[model samples]
Target chain A: MPTMTDEQVRAHLTHEEDLSLLHEVSMKTAGVSRLEMCIQCGSCGGSCPSGMDMDHTPRMVFAMLRAGMRDEVLQSNTPWVCVSCYHCVVRCPQNVHITDVMYTLKAMAIREKKYRDVAAPEFAETFVEMVEKYGRSYEFGLATRHYLKHAPLRMVGMAAMGLGMLRKGRMSMKPRTIKGMDQLTAILNKAKEMELT
Target chain B: MSAYTFYPGCAMESNAKAYYTSLMAVAKPLGINLEEIEDWNCCGATEYVGMNLIPAYSLIARNLALAAKMGNKTVLSPCSACYLNLAKADHYMTERPALGEKVNEALAAGGLHYQPGSLDIRHLLDVLINDIGLDNLKAKVVRPLKGLRVAPYMGCMVPRPDYNNRWSDAEHPVELVEVLQAIGAEVVDFPGAATCCGGHMTQIGPETAFELIRRLISSAERSQADIMVTVCPMCQVNVDAYQGETNRHFGTNYQMPIVFFTQLVGLALGFPPDKLGFGTEITSTEKALARIGVDIPKPTEDTPHKQAGLPMPSCLRKNAKGKVQHAEKEAA
Candidate 1:
C-alpha cells in the first residue's frame, strides 16, 4: 500500500548484457513499462483470449527478452497476433504493460524487417499510408488494397458482403480529406523526424 | 443541456453510420449537446501507435489540441479505439513529461499545443451512464424494450487500462447492465461481454478473428440473447459482418444480430425504428423488433429467478427489487 516517488520508481538501471533486449523494450515503450518487474506468472497468457494462437505467451516473450533472444522474440508471431485487447495488461500482477510491450516489439520487428508473418505489418503500413495521405482512414480503400494483396481469393468471397455494405449505405466509395490536411502533415512529418532522434 | 466536444472518428462516417444516427437521435432527448471538433482527423486507431510512437502520439494529440481549442472541458468519443487512443495519449503525456514535450514539439509544427489534462476524454457510454444518469433515462423510456433480450457486449478497449479509474472493474464492468436495465431490456448473463471481438484481425488474420467471433456468438447463443449490443464499431463490424464467414469456418449456422447500444436506446426513447438506422446491420434485427410489445408486462413471479449456482456473483446479477446487491453484503 506504500506509494513510491516517481524518481524512486525510475532510478534503477537494468543494463546487464543479457537484459539489453528488456532494457531497450522498456525504454522504447512510452511510459514506465515495468517490463523488468515481471514475475513470469503466466497470468497474461492465461487471460489472453488469443493465447492459444500465440507461438509464445506474453510471459514467455518477457522471459525471452530477458534472455536477450532478440531474433526469436521478433520473429515470433506473438506480437502480430496480439489484438491489443489489453486483457493481459490488466491481468498482469506485475503490471508489465503487456499490450504496450507488444506494440514496442511490433515496431522493433518492423524496423529490423525480421517478422515471419507479414500480413499484420503490411496492414499496419497500408493503414498508416492512408492516414498520412488523407488525415483519416478510408475503410473501403483499405479493405480493397489489403484484401487484393494479402487474401486475393478471400477477397472474392468478401465481395458479396462488401456489396451488401455498399447497398445498405454503410461503405463510402471515396475517402474524406480533412480541411486541415496541411497542418496534420506538418505535425506528422515533424514527429517522424523526431522519432529518428 | 450539457455540451461536450465530440470526436466522431472515421467509422461514424462509414461503417458505423447507424451508431452516429442513433446517437444523434437520443442526444436531444437526453439533454446533451454534442459539438463535433472541426476538421478532426482519425486517432490512428491501433495501427499508427505500433508503427512509430512519436507520430502516433502526435496524430492522436492533434485531435486533443483541436478539442482543447474548441473550449470544451470534456471531449467524448463513441468508438472504443478512438476513445482508448485519446485517453492513452493524454495519460502517457502526463505520466511521462519527456514524451509530452516531444509530442508538444510535434504539435507546435501544426500551430497547436495540448496541455494533456486540459480536456477530459470520455467514451459516449460513460457520458450516458454518468452524466445523463440511468434514472433520467428510465423516465424517458416511452416504449420499454420489454421482450427483447440483449447481450450487453462492452468489448475489450473501453473497460481495461483504468487510466482515470473510470470503470468499476476491469474484467466485468456492470455499467452496461445498469444502462440496459434502465431502458427495460432483459440483459443476458453474457460472459463474453468484455471479451475481445478480434478487432482488425479480421483483415490481417481471418482465421484467428473467426475463432474469437465464434466464441462470442456461441456464448450469446448459450445465454439465449435475442441480439448482441456493442459499444464499439469494430466489435459490431467483426461480429455482425463476418458472422456468416465465422459460421462457414466453424460449419455452424448461428444467426446472432449485433447492434449498436444507441440503436436500442433510440427505440426505448420512442423514435421510429427506421429513423434510428435499424435495418442497416448485416444480420437483420427484424425478428428481435417483433418481440417487443407496446408495454412492459409486469413479472408474474414476484422474485427474480436466481442463477442456478453458488449465488451468481453480485456483478452478474440484480436483486428482486431490480437493484444491484453489493458483493460484501451478499457474501455475508
Candidate 2:
C-alpha cells in the first residue's frame, strides 16, 4: 500500500455527517463520563508507547468520536493496537477510561465486521474460539491455529521456539478443560442469549 | 497459614509453566495456603468486553461466584490479565447495578450468585509483599542475588484502576523493588517499568509491538540492569519471547533474560534450579541467572536466537539475465 496523496486524503470517505454514531457510542460508553470531559491534551498521545503504530492517538480518537466520523473511527488502527496498558486511562487529567473505550472501539469493529487492522482481529477471534472451546487457553493449540490461519509462513519460524518450549516442558500437547464445563457453558450461553435481545 | 483461593488463570498450565512451578515452590515458604479454584474458566481477556460487555464480565464474574461459593473472601491470581479481569468484574458489578443484575442472571443458570465486593481479588505480588512480610522473605533467602541488578517490570495492569485502593501508587509502585531488594538484588529505577508492552499487539502488528517491546528492553539495558523481573505472565512471555524480534527490528543485539519475579524469589529462597524451572525462557536465563550463581542450561546451539516475530525473507534485485546482481536485501 502506497502512501496516500493530499488529494486522496481529501477524497477519503468519512461518515462525519452521521450523528447517530456519536449517540450510540455515548450511550454504550456513558459509564465513562470523561468521554465528554477530554480536554484534547496530548498527554495520552505523548505517553502512549505504541502511539506510533496507531492511526490516531487516544486524544485524536476521542475527538474523532465526538466529530461523528463513524467510518474514520472504525477504519483507524488505533483501537486494535491498544494492548490495554492503561497508560492513557491513568494519566488522563479527566480520568477517562481510555483503555476501556479502546475495548469498546475494538468490540464495535468486530460487531460491525469492519477491521482496518488485519492481524489483531484474527488473534482476538482465535483467542475467543480457544476459550469458548476448552474453558482455557491452550498455547500450542492457540499458536498453531492462529499462525496457521493467519500466517503459515511464520509458523516455520515459530517452530523452533514452540518446539523448544515443548521439549523443555514449558508447553503441553494436550488440551486442558476445567471441571464443571457443562455448568460453565450454560452460564456462557445464558449470557449470549441475554445479549441478543 | 493465611488461606486464599488461587486462580492460576489459563496461561499457568501452558506457556507460563515456570511461573506456576516457582509460585508453587514459594507457597510453603511464605506460609500462605492457596487452594486451587476448581472448574475456573477463562476471564475473556481483553477481547470479550469489546464484543459483548455482559458476557465477558459474566464469564469473569463466574469465577468470582465460584470462589465466593467456596466461602473464601480473598482470591489470588499470578497472571496480570486474570487479576485485572477478576478485580474489574468485581468493581464494575458493584458500580453498575443493572450490569450486576444482568451478569447474575447469566450465573443463575449455573445455580450460582455473586455479591459484588464479596471476594477480594489480589495479585500474587501484593500477597507476597503485603501478606507475607518482606522481613520473612528476606529471612528465608538462602542465596541472595547480591550483585545482580534487576529491573522490576510490573507491566501495567497491577498498578492502575486500583478500584480497591490496594496499590500504594498507580504509576510507580515500589512493591516489586521492595520484594526484590529483600532478596538482595539491586533494583533499578526503570521508567518503562509501568509502560505498556502492547499486550497482544505483537500478533496484531509486529512493527507496532516491536517498538513498544524495544522501549522496555532498551530502557532496562540503559539502566544497566542484569535482567528484568516481572510479576505478570503476559509481560514475561512478551518480553522474553519477542525480545529477539525486538532486537532484529532495531539491529541491536540485546540478550536480556525476562524472568518471572517468583523464579528469582524461589532461587533466593534456596529452591533448586530444576525445581523452580528457570531454564524454560526463550531469552535464555543462563546469563542472567549466572549473576546469582544459579546456572541453568543454555537455549541450544542450533538456534542462535529464539524464533520470534515475522521472519524477514531476503529479496534480491534481478538483472536482465535474472542472475543475482546484488546482495540480498531485507524484505520490508
Candidate 3:
C-alpha cells in the first residue's frame, strides 16, 4: 500500500453526515447513547494522554462518527493511537464511553481494512497472534518480531535494553508454552464461530 | 487465610518477573495464599479485544472458566491489565446476555463454562490494601520506608471503568498512596498519578509514546518523588524500559526509576531484599530506593549523584473537579 498523501487524507474529511455508521457503532459499544449528546466540551481532548499523536482529537472523532464520515473515521489514527486510558471516558461530562467508542472504531477500522498507522494494527496482530499461538506471550520474542516487522532500525537502539533485561532474567529468551493449549484452541475456535453470528 | 486462584498473566513469567517475585515474597507474610490456576492462558490484553470482541472475551473468560472449574470464587491478578481484562469480561458477560451466551457457547466446546459474576476477580492491590487493611500492613512493616518520597502511579486501567465500584476514586485513586503511606513511605501528591502511560503505543509509535512517558516522569519529578511505584506491568515497562529512549527523544535527563507496587510492599513486609528482585530495572533504581535499604547498583561515571538536575517542566495538574489546572494558573 502506498503511503497516504496529505491531499488524499484531506479529501476524505467528513462530518456527522449520516446516522447509519453512528447507529452501527452505538449498537456495538455500551454507554454509546452519550456520543450523540456530546457537547464537544473538549474535556476528553484535554485529558487524553496521546491526544497530540492523533490526526483528530477524540472529541472530533466522535463528532466525525456522528457526522457519518465513515471514510474519514475509519482512516483516522485516533482509534489506533488511543491507549484506552479512560481519562477521557472518566472525564467526559456526557458520560460517553469514549474509550469503548475508540475500541468500536478500532474494530471497525480493522474489519474495513482502513489504517491510519499500519504499525498499530501490526502490533495488535503480532501480540494477539503470539497469545493465540502459545497461550502466553514471549516478551523478548514478541518485541524482536514486532520491531523486525515494523521498524528494524529502531531495534538496534533497543538492543542494549533487551540485553540488559536478558542479563537480569527479566525477559524470556524462549517461549513459555502452557498445557492444554489444544483445549484452548477448541474454545477459541468456537469463539471465532460465535463472533461470526 | 483466604486462598484464591492466582492468574499470573503472561508478563509475570517474562517481563514483569520482579512483580511476580515480589508479590510471592509478601504473600506468605501477609497470610495470603495463592494457588496458581492450572493451564491458564493469556488475558488477550487490549489488542485482542480490538481485533475481535467475543474471542478476546472468551480468551479471558477461559481463565475465569478454569478458576470456576477449580471451585475458586476469587481470582487474584497482580498485573493491572490482566486484572482489568478479567474483570471486564466477567462483568460484561453477565451484564449483556447476548455476550454471555456467546462466550458460554465457546466454553461449551471444551466442556467448560463461565457463568459470569461467578468468580470474584480482583487486582492484587485491592486484595492487599482493601482486604488485608492498612493497619495489618503497618503491623508487618519491619522496615518503614522513612523519608522516601514516592509517587503512586496506578496507570489508567486499574481504577477506571470500575466494574464493581471497587476503587476509591478512578481519577485520583489514593489506595496506592494509602498502602505506601501505611508502609512508611512519603507518598507525594502526584497530580498525574492516574495518568495514562500510553500502553503499546511505545511499540507502535515511539515518538508519541515517549511524550506520554515523558509526561508521567516529568509529573513525578515535579512532585519531588524519588521513585515512581506502579501497579500495572505495562506502566512499569513503558516508564522503566522506555525512560532512556524517552529522555533521548525529549532532550531530557530524567532518570526516574519505576518499580512494581508489590515490590515496595514486600520490602515493607520485611521480606528478604533479594526476594523483591530490585536490580532488574533498566533504569538504575539505587538512588531512588536507597532509603528503603535495598541494595542498588553502584552509580556509573555517567549517572552522577548529588548533582543538580534539569528543572521540572511546568505541566497541568488535575484539580478537585477533575479538570487539568495549569501549574502557572495555580501558582498565580
Q: Which runs in model 3 stand beyond 4 Å of their true positions?
A: A1-18, A30-39, B297-332
**By DockQ, who's the top model here?**
1
Query: Interface Cα RMSD for candidate 1?
Result: 12.1
| Candidate 1: stretches off by over 4 Å | A1-17, B293-332
**Cα-based lDDT at residue B67, candidate 2:** 90
Docking class of 1: acceptable
Which tens-of-lDDT digit does each residue in B1-332 have in candidate 3?
A: 77989999988987798898898888887889999999999998888888887788888888998888887788999988899889888877776678888888998888888887888999998998777888998998988999889999988888997879999998989899999999899988888888888898888878888888988999999999999999988998999988888887888999999899888888777776567878778887888777666785431222111132212322311121122122113322
DockQ of every predicted complex: 0.36, 0.32, 0.31
Question: Over all chains combined, what TM-score does candidate 1 have?
Answer: 0.89
Clashing pairs in 3: A15-A67, A16-A66, A16-A67, A17-A67
What is the per-residue lDDT of model 2 for residues A1-197, given as tens digits with 9 covering 90 to 100?
78988876665434444546655665554143357678999888887877877789989988888777777788888888777887777788988778777777777888787876566777877777777788887667777777887778866655555656654556665677877788878888998876421
Q: Which ten residues in a row have the lowest lDDT in candidate 3 chain B?
A: B316-325
> What TM-score results for chain B in every one of the models?
0.88, 0.89, 0.88
Tens-digit lDDT track of model 2 for B106-204:
999989899988889999999988898999899999888899999999888999867788887888988998999999999988988787786877676
Compare candidates 1 and 3 on lDDT and give the better one: 1
- Full-model lDDT, candidate 2: 0.79
For residues B263-303, write the lDDT of model 1, one tens digit per residue.
89998999987668787787867777778842222212211
